[model samples]
Target: MVSGQLFNHKLLDVVFENANYGTIIIDNNGKIQYISNKYCEFLEVDREDLIGGYIVDFIENTRLHLVVQTGKSEMGDLQFLRGSFVITNRIPIFDDKEIIGAIGTIIFRDLDDWKKMNSHIKDLLARNNLYTPEVDQANGARYSLHDLIGNSHEMNELKERVKRVAGGDISVLIRGESGTGKEIIAQSIHQLSTRSTKPFVSVNCGSIPEHLIESELFGYEEGAFTGAKKGGKVGKFRSADGGTIFLDEIGDMPLHMQVKLLRVLQEREYEPVGSLQPKKVNVRVIAATNRPLEKMIENREFREDLYYRINAIQLVSPPLRERTEDIPLLIQHFFEKAKARIGKRVNSIHNDVYELFKKYSWPGNIRELENVMDAGVHLSNEEFLDIDALPEYIKRDSENIRRDSEKIQKKTLKELVEETEKEEIERTLKNCKFDKNKAAEALGISNSTIYEKIKKYGITE
Candidate 1:
């Protein structure tokens, strides 16, 4: 029995000395019974000085003795020793179901080891902090109803509809030609909704690549694919939980993605790419598109089911030419806005400039009007915006209208009135780029009236 005990002690001593980790063993009285050579090297102490000494005397913030007293184990606890951090595990040594001592093992041999294991984690956390606020701001609504800036009857009715719809949780579809402030209307609705305080995540479905749209909307797991982030990313849907998601250009979303989007809209849950678990989210969806979804559905470019799902409420934004009466108000609003931005004060605009603007059809809507005002504010040296301040395209268009008016002046009084009406009708049609429906709307006349005039005057594009 003595020889057997001697062999066991030899085996333990050999194992402790050759072990790759730093370890120490202490008796129930908290006196160190054994210290590995690796442990002594970690502390920069000699084995002679540490052996038989109380562990607390040599180690700062030591907890191994507490483990012996409590008869418990602490796994993966961080400890600061000799100005460096080490991850350690402490366990009570058992002998016949009674605690006789305690053993502490250090997982990292040194500070460098701990840093190597944690550097990637630290980087990922830093990136998350850096991206969080940016994500919030990018996803947040930047406009309200007051930003719509129009006083036409169509504008008034659209505003009223938006106000009524803002109080509900129904999905909305905003349809208009490009640059007609479709996004502005969508944002206005979101800001007035109960979910206004939460994130307003915006995604341009057409802007993202087709292959990557799924992952961008429903994030991927780490290592799920090549070049994935170290930690999985939160997708737009998850980020917009309990808030609104403004899907700009939703019509441009690919066919496959449309099916997935339809499912999310119906089920209110989605599984991230490469993840089996589905995440539930409460998000209000507001979609905008310039494309005619009905036409797209007919052509099989868009899904009919998805269209019906998203179009629970529909809002149409009238084009700028259709709201010609609002041009002066819009110009003054844009002029003032531009004055503040450019640090120039233009108190007045030439009447001819306004006439020119009225004559030119704004195909780009309010966005184009703002750009023109911005250019005029910067180019005008005088306090009034003149013809010279206009863009070259507008200037040429204005000259053509002036020449047409001059030719009308040479006719007889009754002939002059009829020619003036013809000129005005033709000009309006030309400004609307020969879209009969839009031209009728712009002229505040019925489509049938415009069609009759086109037939009577024999107007041809």
Candidate 2:
């Protein structure tokens, strides 16, 4: 028995359908362009009679037109028909920035049968789910807030901030030092937003060459340039329509491209390199950078107007040092990931290794920490990540810090105070050319007291 019944028999023009599963395709106008012969057999209807009919007229409870209009997928939706629940998936077909049509598939004829999935079907679905060719092309969000791995105050605040701003389509500027996981924050925001199913196109503005960025972003026609592709291609902007585009290292974007980007943000439209007509897009812009945009603006290296436009809502990711409490959590997370990836039996991290990790200042932040874990896991000859497995810098820095800390701990409070005072007085005297009066004034002390301290500390300069 067919799930859809012909409601409109009037003829309309149509074209397109995929038949691997009981599939159907409809044009933007909801007119059925193609119906698989298998489905026609299932419906016991003549293919000629259904081809030009409106999908709603031919299919029971169809939402194909809804996807065509919204350009968003409706996957695994339950449709109760003929005393049983059926599962359906409707996906919009996009041509550049516009939705051309929608395709549908009858995933499950009945809900009960779907629950006890056959092994072959389950494997096929699993492989497709891993990365449907469409998904790879979509640049879907890979990480969500749940994968953000942190429990510190700073991390909690950052998570809350991301949650608050993710509901809107406004521009978001993520400011942080390099390797502070700015892109992770960007992905989390996209995944949490209304456009989660849509593409999450990430472009590292700094990585692309200066000469190619414009065409890389706005695209170009086939004959626009000597080295252009045969058919021409949609730019990242067009590919990101109805979704989010994460512009990483945004400060490195050239001034000319910034101008075009500013216009696109203002007008929500852009012209491809050789196209006469401009195409409109509905995309959320999430820009991130480690550079000081204000400084860049002051130096005239960045556009002030564009800065304000993208910085309407700003988020600053705290450096790893600022969230030290989360270091152990991140360590464990990376360690486990490395274990699985490397297929190693490294069972534990030594207490000394943890101490060194906690003591060292992570200049490269979380990225550096992850690298160290990977190296240690690979180098470990035993079941633990010990000092022998760590990089040389880790041990050297840890030892130096330990020695300095021991020396400081051995000093009495009064001796430490005097040592600090002596260093300050000597530096001041040298800067003042050894003039007692000048040194005293600079040190905020009386001349006589300065002289006494200098003498007491045995300063002879």
Candidate 3:
């Protein structure tokens, strides 16, 4: 720590070039006074070359220069460079209210480094919260639009909607029944977006405990609360910095957290626990829920303001039952996925399985089908998946569906109408002491016609 004028490049050349952390010192005008070796590596450039360049020339979206101008400090802030969020701090050096230079420190180079740091933090936080954070910080988007898989009209339209929404930088809310692949749609949107190169963090709002929800989403400072770690932990919003965050089962999020989430959505900034300053964030949110948010709002369980903020664009995942035409496609896809994943010789599926799948209502949607296929493949020693390989509950459902189908198939519309007519005529006759004229008037038909219908239906006195 020298207090002298050592901002010259050649003076600190050897020292800064070999620094372990990604550190940068910029003058009040945002000119690079010095850039450390680690930062040069993250920037994919030579330290000597970047020593005297402008900060904006290298970083896509940085606010360090602004920090120097405003003399305001920003710590634990996220900045996007290349294809990842680099957690950084920008502290302005001031001499009696006069700004001199700003020091910027970065956390990680890429997703791998971020994962290493995040995993450590999760380990520390898990013991206290009894929950582990999502590993979405390791990468962006696991599935693509192609993974949506279906040629039905509902699927076609939904896919098109995804493509359209992906091009924009706005909040998206995905609505669907449980197991209908809402998270898949969310991932698809992130995969197709411009931020696909960054992280895709997922959080199950309902799965998280109510008490820990605040710290989990917004992070906390050192000793912020009773169980707060030494250095505090970065939340999902920070990990997702410049990428996307998926909030699944959002309706289950507590009302207090909903207010905090609404603040982030509205302000694009969040104050971590025990910290007075609000760290700036630039993340796209894609929330999913099977529950009716509007109804929840009516019940005063959800915030109406937050609803509008997240509902900038909405997509409805088509229930599997509604698009039965895609059942065959989904079956083959999940079948191949399961077979490949299991690394087995389960190469074929019986025709009866396909028929049963097509006939079933699929109350649990695509996820249930995938799970069944996975279980079936796992249980199969034979080459083909047969009725015997299916679960007993599925077999029962299939049988009931087939029986209902047969019952409908056995009777024609005319036969059913005549049978109903015969029963009503007999009822009216019984009510009127079997008088033909009175029965005809009560039946709303001619006496001859009623007699003919009764004979046709095999009804006799």
Candidate 4:
């Protein structure tokens, strides 16, 4: 006989009957003992029709048979008969230690709903030009803050700083080596900020002609200059009025343009090159540069005042050589991305290929790394990548460095004495990570010797 609290038990059944998921219970004879109203609605059947039907008769997939036979719960994918909608979940109920009955539920996922959510997210990322064919491309070139992978303390600190600074309205100056993904970081900040819903305009300051820079930045009126369009083109600043404007290679910007740029930054308004009217725009500016602006200012190349204006919040990005540990993660990420795009079955990379990568100094940083990996994926004949598929430049440079070491090993007395002086300097540079001042102290050699050898070795850093 059933136990006490029959009324309370009925109230619980009423609550389960109203659930969104399709829930069912079957008896020892494989007949439906109890099925929720939601389950019948999913099956598009009346309650009376489903009450005595076999549970297996309705379940589309035979994979559910294991759960019924073994008295153990199991989950798998399934599709409904009417809508053909894809659903996934488990058989939930059991009668005893022996196989007797089961209950199952479904989770319906619509592709249209997923597409809508994905499109909305892409708009939030402020993706302008789609770089779909690039090695790092994922899901049609939508990048999130999480995609910026690096465990280096410097990278982590930079990410934390981006999160904090994204809320404020201050101008940011990102200083880093070229090909180090400065533009990516700029977009990430814009996407994470309150202005995510707004536009994000990226302009390569050095790419545009000096004469056209003014008009490109501030919109000109119709017929402002000779051969001007009938309808004035909107400037990047105006296009990014409520969002952000990324100025790349700002150090190469002409001095006259710098003066005008500084004025606009101070006043938040600018007259278009061809227009008499001044347009006001509320835009957050983020500038990036590979050159040393501080040295430029001292040499009277970059304006000191303009540097101070943009440098309100400075972010220094470390080069790839400084973060050698992140190479493996970058390789794996690019491999998966390439496989998805090219439909290749590449599953692994040679261990020696990674060792070679870590040994060489990447002058072009992450961008170069992506290019190298992409080329390897396309050119590789084997299922996994090997060193033979790498570019000639990388192979030649590494070969030259290794050959130089071998030459030092084989030398006569006079040659050994001559090389000993040079060897001492090279050893110090390696220990100091090529920092001249530290190398001088460690070698007990003069700073001038360190500088002289640096020129001889062709070390730029």
Q: Write the per-residue lDDT of candidate 3 for residues 133-187, one digit (tens) a residue.
A: 2333356556666668799999989977886677457899999999998987898
Please provide, for model 4 over 301-327, each residue's C-alpha lDDT reduced to its tens digit, 9 standing for 90 to 100: 899999999999988888989988888
For candidate 2, write residues 1-461 as lDDT tens digits: 11232222222112112323467878788988777665665455889998778988878777889998899998887653321234678998776677778888775343223322222232233244642223323457766665567899888888777777776678999999998899889987776565666789999999999999999998999899888899898899999998899999999999999999998999999989989999999999999999989999999999999999999999999888888888889999999999999999888998888778887899999999999999999999757889889898887898899899999999999989999999999999999999999999998999899989988999987
* Candidate 1 accuracy as TM-score: 0.61
Could you tell me which residue pairs clash in candidate 1? none
Positional deviation of 165 in candidate 4, in angstroms?
A: 1.4
Q: Which scores better on lDDT, 1 or 4?
A: 1
| Model 2 TM-score, 2 decimals | 0.66
> lDDT of all the models against the reference?
0.81, 0.80, 0.81, 0.72
Clashing pairs in 3: none
- Residue runs of model 3 more than 4 Å from their true location after superposition: 1-137, 410-461
Error of 1 at 13 (Å): 78
In order of TM-score, best first, we have 2, 3, 4, 1
RMSD of each: 19.9, 13.1, 15.4, 14.0
Give stretches of model 4 more than 4 Å off.
1-142, 401-461
| Model 2 CA deviation exceeding 4 Å by range | 1-138, 418-461
Which one wins by lDDT: 2 or 4?
A: 2
TM-score against truth, every candidate: 0.61, 0.66, 0.62, 0.62
lDDT of 3 at 397: 93
